[model samples]
Target: MTKPISGFSKLTKEEKIDWVTANFTQNAAQSKKILQTYWNQNDSVQQLHDEFIENTITNLYVPQGIAPNFLINETLYAIPMAIEESSVIAAASKAAKFWLKRGGFKAKILGTEKVGQVHFIFKGDAKKLESFFTYLKPVLLAESASLTKSMEKRGGGITDIVLKNKTDELANYFQLHATFETKDAMGANFINSCLEQFATTLKKEATRYDAFSRQEKDVEIVMSILSNYVPNCTVRAEVSCPVEDLKLSAELTPQQTAEKIIQAIKIAQIEPYRAVTHNKGIMNGIDAVVLATGNDFRAVEAGVHAYACRNGRYSSLTHAQIENGIFKFWIELPLALGTVGGLTNLHPLVKLNLEMLQRPSAQELMQIVAVAGLAQNFAAVSSLVTTGIQKGHMKMHLLNILNQLGANENEKATLTEYFKTNPVTHHGVEIQLSSIRK
Candidate 1:
């Protein structure tokens, strides 16, 4: 059994790895070798990566790839995606190419507003609290001037502040709801700074409010933070072409192909089981782009999943329809992205990605992200409706299995050509590998 040690973080990287492998791993030597192999050769670069987060041992790599030929609003772009999933980049690239032959994707910014809140408990009369808030609104805004001034000069700042009484849900619960326009940045820091100031101002002014008694004036601040559920910070991306343009088959006509695709989307909308996986496929694309751009994928995922269930049932994020001889597929969701802050300016690859994208503003990034998700869904569904999903997916996954079983380059090459016509399965590959060894 492994025993915990003190000052584990204080140990040097080699020492920590040595201790871990010795105590925990079955193949201690091999484990240490694998970990050390991934470390950056340059000491300076290795130190930079280690300092990115706490208790870093070595870098974990995900492949960075490009999906080209994405045309949104008459502007063409090649989207950068960072992901370990085998078929994701290929699927996105195929979808972009398919759409390019038809009229390309079109996207529009729906809104740019982000949200934050200050939660507090007020054990006071509701009417008294309301009266005090009226007096407190300007004080909250005025006190946040220093925090919001830089944001304001960039044409982005605090847009609105309102009081929300949630006493019925939980006793003495109240929130100061705030909204902001972050322009070219994700604005988590900006919104959080403003919220902290709101919390401080509310507490300071509550003591002097003429409307509150001593007990009422003592507002217990629970927390002040930015909300990831940015409903107003949204964009819509869609692709539309004549049904006749979807010539996907010789057996079934273009109209039939469109009908089948729409039916697949409809099932996802009404069925929760299918909807969950369906939405995940969409996020496979969204999250990849979000990571590549060095934005917060966790926040984006939380906000998006919340939005999915907003209609009471979690449904599909991408919608498809056949109308007036036209086939259209589209997606609309909130994405809090930044172009000039956070890892966007720090990570070298992120800066290169922004340059590759022509340095779009926040709104433009939203459109690009939404398009990636839509393209991903289109490719997935197109495969599901026609050739079935596993054909391409299993082929892509073959390389991973081969590497896992320790196939050399020559063996991998032979099997790659063999699997072109042969179906790939774990058991089947194992059998083939054994036969080759024999």
Candidate 2:
């Protein structure tokens, strides 16, 4: 509501929560929980979290943190995120360091507006029913609050609406598409809230939307849910590394390192199965931020994967290339996403993250998120080009192996060296475990 906050700061925790709720559309249940979780200390058997996860989740607070030094479009901005992951901060920072000298990324948004689908099914002629929609269009346009004031103030809001009919292998269904622009808040809550009222007028126009039940066979409004396949908007970030900047090791040539990243991206583009993992790697940064902000990570993931197959071939959500000795990156996903309005306002950490980001508009949030995705992808590809994913992953995993036996730093290093030479297995670990014990 307040210019899609890039950060939430200077307010008491309660005020911060209030500010987020007033600005965005929060589920009623989530809002209540946010309030109760702050005051209530009941630690009964009713808690769903296991002891380990509970250590982080206690008090139902997931603080939001801002990622700094995001140089996008000549603007240095702070990004808000809700997540708990080791090395993400480190990775983003390292990635930013890699790009800083080469020239910061220039990122752009396709737009800020999103789409909502209100499905209505009834026994009527497709053409005549379509005409009925045409008749109702003017009426929908005439309504006030039809356009969000917050969006319209910033030059975005409901631009158009259409009704279309599509048939599946099962049957034909009617889908009413409400195309609206929400300025800073993710518009799902706004669109759904609007549709709740609009459905009233729609039911009056069509008999099918009016009735229900097994007692009679009639057209029904089965489920009215917001679609995350936001085609109207896309965010892109591009950074060029001079061929010289790619050097991380003496053995690898800058061009070869860039080439390896390009080759990996090419594989992701061509292979659907690999693309899934490829995108998942990118989402490691994305979902962590989403969870940190109280936004729906699952919905964002679903829509991104669904959008990946827009051309009917499963492919990577991101595209990377090496041109003129510089590595370029771009990602196009239906970032129909938000920072406030749901659990973002409920959870503690998420609140902290938004406070740090201070983003007021959804478009700004998307820009930061898109940049993070690009940065994360770059880190992933860079890591792959140098040492490979397994080695880096195993490096972190080895710490756990060392800790289980209380090995000191030097001992842990020695154990890692042992694993590098030996066949890694539980049985092998046990054998080494004995040797280390002695």
* Top-scoring candidate (lDDT): 1
**lDDT of each model, Cα atoms only?**
0.92, 0.68
Give a tens-digit lDDT track for model 1, residues 1-438.
Answer: 667799988998889899988988899999999998999898887887888787887799999999999988889999999999999999999999999988799999999899999999999898888888898999998999999999999999999999999999999999999999989989999999999999999999999887789999899999999999998889999999999988765777888889999999999999989999999999999999999999999999999999998899999888888888889999999999999888898887789999999999988999999999999999999888888899899999999999999998988998899999999998888889888888
Assess candidate 2 and give its lDDT: 0.68
Alpha-carbon TM-score of each model against the true structure:
0.97, 0.75
What lDDT is reached at residue 21 by model 2?
58
Off by over 4 Å in 2: 1-69, 77-87, 143-156, 168-172, 207-219, 343-348, 358-360, 404-433
Clashing pairs in 1: none
Which runs of model 1 end up more than 4 angstroms from their true locations? Answer: none
